[model samples]
Target: MINKNVFNKTKVSLIKINVAVVVSFFIIFSIFIYSYFKGLTYNSVDRNLNDELENITVQLTSSAIFSPIVLKDPSNMVYIYEGDRVKYYTRNGYFEDMLPKFRENKKNSFFTYTENGYTFRELSLEIGKYKIQIIRNIDAQINSFKQLIYVFVIGIIIAIIITYFIALYLTKKALIPIETAWNNQAKFVQDASHELRTPISIVSSKLESMLRSPNSTISDEVELIADAMKETRRIKKMINDLLCLTKEDSITTLNKEEVNIEQLINEISNDYLDIAEVQNKKFNINLNAENKIIITDKNKLRQLILIFIDNAFKYTNKNDIICINLTEEGRDIIISIEDSGIGIKDDEISNIFDRFFRSENVRSKDIDGSGIGLSIAKMLSTSLDIDISVKSKLNEFTKFNLIIHNK
Candidate 1:
């Protein structure tokens, strides 16, 4: 399991990074959208004012009698000035006080003016001796632009809230594999230590027994010394197995070549035949596969087969039959190793490949094993793309089949 504090810190860091990136993108996008619409809103109003100014100028220069009532848009107001005096105006009564004082210097220009809470866009144009000003109320368009800003602010806030939860979810999902690997590593270390403790304790106790008999001759302590040496060799073998597993874990490449499958099996059978004769056991081999050549890591394949054959020898007594059979099934090769020995229970077969996992029957018989051999075999099988299956019944027989795809 991952530590609580470390997990939380890592999750928070990831969430913060994700949210920060989203927030920056949203803010920039919102600014661009707001500016584009704002420009469009004001440009429409300016274009309308320009059209009105042009119409007024054309009427004044056409020698037609200009009448304010002839204006098509009622919202627009026109004022004609001459020498700082209002000569003609569009609106009736004393509405001149509401309009700005006209100036001759301000010509062909547009500006915004607010008076008594009313906003207007004004255009000034000089025609002959007349100074003309055109004004339009723009309070509605201003209110609409303000609403657009409000929408963007609210939209950005909502998007950020959604992004926070999304970032949190994705961060947890990404860390699951890391957490699992860490927990597995912790368990592996714990199991390895537990397996090493027993042999070390036996060796230490044997040495202590010898030290107490210091006055005795070497012949008198022969059994004690032998026991200690046996345990020491067991410890050494366990260490080597552990080192092999660790190395296999770190390997990312395979040294593959064409290997004659029948020849490889015969070589292993020859070596184990000598062991069987010395131990008073029966050994047999049946090779029936026609296509014998396979492309794989030959050394790893040899080691895998040796693990199964060695286990058969360890678990069986005198006169027990151990057989290796190779046959072809379609385009795949199947290798079977069968032993009439102390077999495994049906329930324990599934867990035989776990590291340091020994069955109750094996433990009861006091078999000499570290229980890591099958685990290493499983790793090698996976690396070589070989599928393994087991069949066994307690106190009867055990069989393991390795399926090698020809492709």
Candidate 2:
């Protein structure tokens, strides 16, 4: 009972959820990898800064206390101290405030400091009558980490966008069958209602007319009663046909046996002979296969033949020829029913098997039919594993071919 709109919405929601989960996993994995490598890079830079500080301490210890340990590298900043007074230092003017406080609270041998929007890694060492402080600027490395974070954010955004579109495409493809079934079910309910409404209304109106004319004698009301009974019978038959269509799958339970194909055809042809005679039509039977046995569901097969013959009787004109032919083509048994009746239009032939479908020509005529017989036959054929096909030219002839695999 699912409607097309709700079915489509459910499909789209599921697709979105799946896309979100996959994209979230990818983003988390990417962030984990980036953070691991970034941590390694920072560790390497810290170790190198500490190693350079150790080398500078070794040089100062090897030299005299007042030997003036001059360093000209602009990237390296050094602070040389003797007791509580500064003996020599590099960039003292730039780090005057930061170095003084750092020297006073020299609790940790290595520490980090931020000054004037730049980060510095500081290492303090006590070297033979001198305390040396070495500083390395790490602003570039911090900026690189920030840039990496930005790149990951952008990549996640793009991935989400791509995943959304991909999910939309896949959901559309996956919902094709569900949407088709939903629409078909809706159409079926609508068609069934329309078909039942006419007969019920006719019967109700006929009975009401009889009720209003209570004093009318039985003879006067006979025609009205007959009309009501006829409509009631038509309604019953339509209901039976609907039930048969619905339970077409039960054909599989039919007691299958080796049935004589020629004899079955001959029997059906004889049964329709009188009906054809009343219409002045020629009903012909042709059995070309020498081997006439086929393993099949006999009762269901009889129903199929009756449906075709009845249709032939209804659609064909007086004196038109109707031929039923049974033949063998290799490993298959083919039963063909061709009628020279008022043939179906080429366009209408394809839809002849649809439920309650009648051709415009057939509808225009005063024919008594519920239009569900062919649909029932088609369903039965499907359940019995038989292939049914049709070919027709407007106003010439219409033919149906039923193929059964002869095992």
Candidate 3:
């Protein structure tokens, strides 16, 4: 089962990632493009302001009379303050001569006025002691930048939304092969496991029966037959492990019904008790649940419980105890199986449910394990929408938890 902290998908969620990436990229790109064009527009406006100022300067410097003059025009209004003689001339007020306190502004200056709407440069010079000043409004450029910035921000938002769907479409196309490969791999493992089971079972059963028969046709054939049986058993054990590894959720859907959880556990406990007594082993059940009613597939759920009980009996030594606990953990129904004998190593516990995975330590001990018990349990739990997990410590205990959803 997947943790709640991280996002998980039974199938790949590539579309979500693709949508996020594309939208993020487009928003950043739109900002870059907007800034690029806006910067170009600002540069052009600045150049135009400079040219207007330069042209005014040229017209003023070319005048022959030393008298003040007003140059009236559509784009600009010029006023010449006849200095030293205290003469003043006013036109459209596009240009203004600085007072004597601002005499240094006769060279180059920047100023703003609310009426014309500009903070612009004033290029003025002394012409026969009459200061002629040139000025042009930069308000248009300022307004242009403000409006463009607002539009750019809005455009980026709209572009990001549009890019999300396009990214989803593209991601779906790219992930096709991955989906196919995953399905094929799962199908292959499932098929291979099914095909191998019958042969391995026949070999093991034949070997066991042969071992039981002390009196055979030929007396000399005992040692030879025993050796062959040993090899056959070993081969069978390996194949069982392979089959366990390949198991999958072949059970499609369940005819779900309201069953008493305690009753089911009790019935499985009774079956385990009989089997354990017959095998000269021991088993126990711990019922911690106050409630018993649960809606689920009775057969598959029973199979899962039985497999755990059987596995504990098979692996444990004679008279070893196998514990089964049915309880509630938060919203989930927690069913746990703890065995006293042959607990798995800490490192191997994680891979224990994997198809054909037996611990290296377990293999060294040469205990018979097809390794499919946990795998089948896992698949069955998955089909039933239950979560299964395990924890084991060497020589101490091994525990399996089947956590069923409340729904």
Candidate 4:
């Protein structure tokens, strides 16, 4: 089981990192957007001021009279100075008394002038002998910029809130697989320890029995020595199975090659025939597929089939029948291993592939198995993209079907 506190801490850490990245990105983006729009707004005002100054300069130079229409807009105030004396003047409403002082050195320059809580953009230009000054009120543009700043601040806050929730959801979703793997790994360690402890204890007890009778010769204590050695071999085999599982877990890719399905099954069947004859059990193989070649990891396929066949023999008694059938349906090649044995209960069928799982019947009968064989088979089938299914009835028959898709 996963510790709740640790899981929550992990989730919080991920969410914090995600939210921090989002906040940093949005802050930089907000600054860029504000700066760009602000410059654009102020540049529009400056361009307008320059245009008005040009028009006024052209009118004064080409004609003797100044056009009143040019100064009709009250937001703008214009002054023309000739040698420090006012040559021409137009007063804007409410800003008539706040005119800027003329400067001889300020030629073709733009500046901001503030007076009586009012702000203006002023442009000074020299037109021949006369100096022209144009001031435009920019209080409204400044207010609009302030509003834009407020909008950005509020937008960022809203974005942060939404992003926090989204990050929370995604982090939880991402941790599910990790949590499952953690629990599975913990269970696997516990089971492995339990399995190893039993045989080790038995071997220790057998050896202690032999030690207690030190005077007995080797021939007199042969049974105890044999039992100890048997348990030791069982321990060795279990450790090898565990290592196999670890190796399989670390394998990310498979070595696939052309494998002749018929030849492979025939070879496996030949080996099992000898075992069947010794055990007084009947063994048969039926290969019906027209196309027997498949692209797959051949070693893995062989190991997977051997597991089923070995299991079939383990649960069956003398004179029982074990059959291996190979057939084709559509693009799939089906290989089945069936036996007249003490079959699995319906409820336990789903759990047969779980690591260290043994059915109640097998446990009660004390059948020899480490319970890792089917789990390894399951892993191999998954890697080979083969589908395995079972049909069984308790105390009657058990059948395992492996469906290999032709690629």
Candidate topping lDDT? 4
Candidate 3 lDDT, 312-407, residue by residue in tens: 776788777888898997778999998987888777777777655667767787766666667777778878998888887777677888898977
Residue-wise lDDT of candidate 4 within 151-249, one digit each (tens)?
889988998899999999999999999999999999999999998998899999988888899899999989988988888998898898898888975
What are the lDDT figures for the candidates, one per model?
A: 0.86, 0.81, 0.66, 0.87
Model 2, stretches more than 4 Å misplaced? 1-26, 46-116, 120-137, 164-180, 215-222, 243-281, 290-303, 317-319, 380-385, 394-396
Ranking by TM-score: 4, 1, 2, 3
- Residue 255 of model 3 has an lDDT of 82
The model with the greatest TM-score is 4
Model 3, position 124, has a per-residue lDDT of 48
> Model 4, 138: alpha-carbon shift in Å?
1.0
lDDT of 1 by residue, 1-407 (tens): 45879989999999999988998998899889888887886688778877777777776767445444245566778887766777666763324475665645656877776766777787888877888888787888778878988887898889889998999899999988888888878878888899889989999998999888889888999998899899999999999999988897543258999999999999989998889999999999999999999999899899999999999999998999999999999999999999999999988999999988999999998989898999999899998999999999888899999999989
Q: How close to the true structure is residue 297 of candidate 1, measured as C-alpha lDDT?
A: 88
In model 4, where do residues sit more than 4 Å from their true spots? 65-69, 92-97, 101-107, 249-252
RMSD in Å for all candidates: 3.6, 5.4, 14.0, 2.6
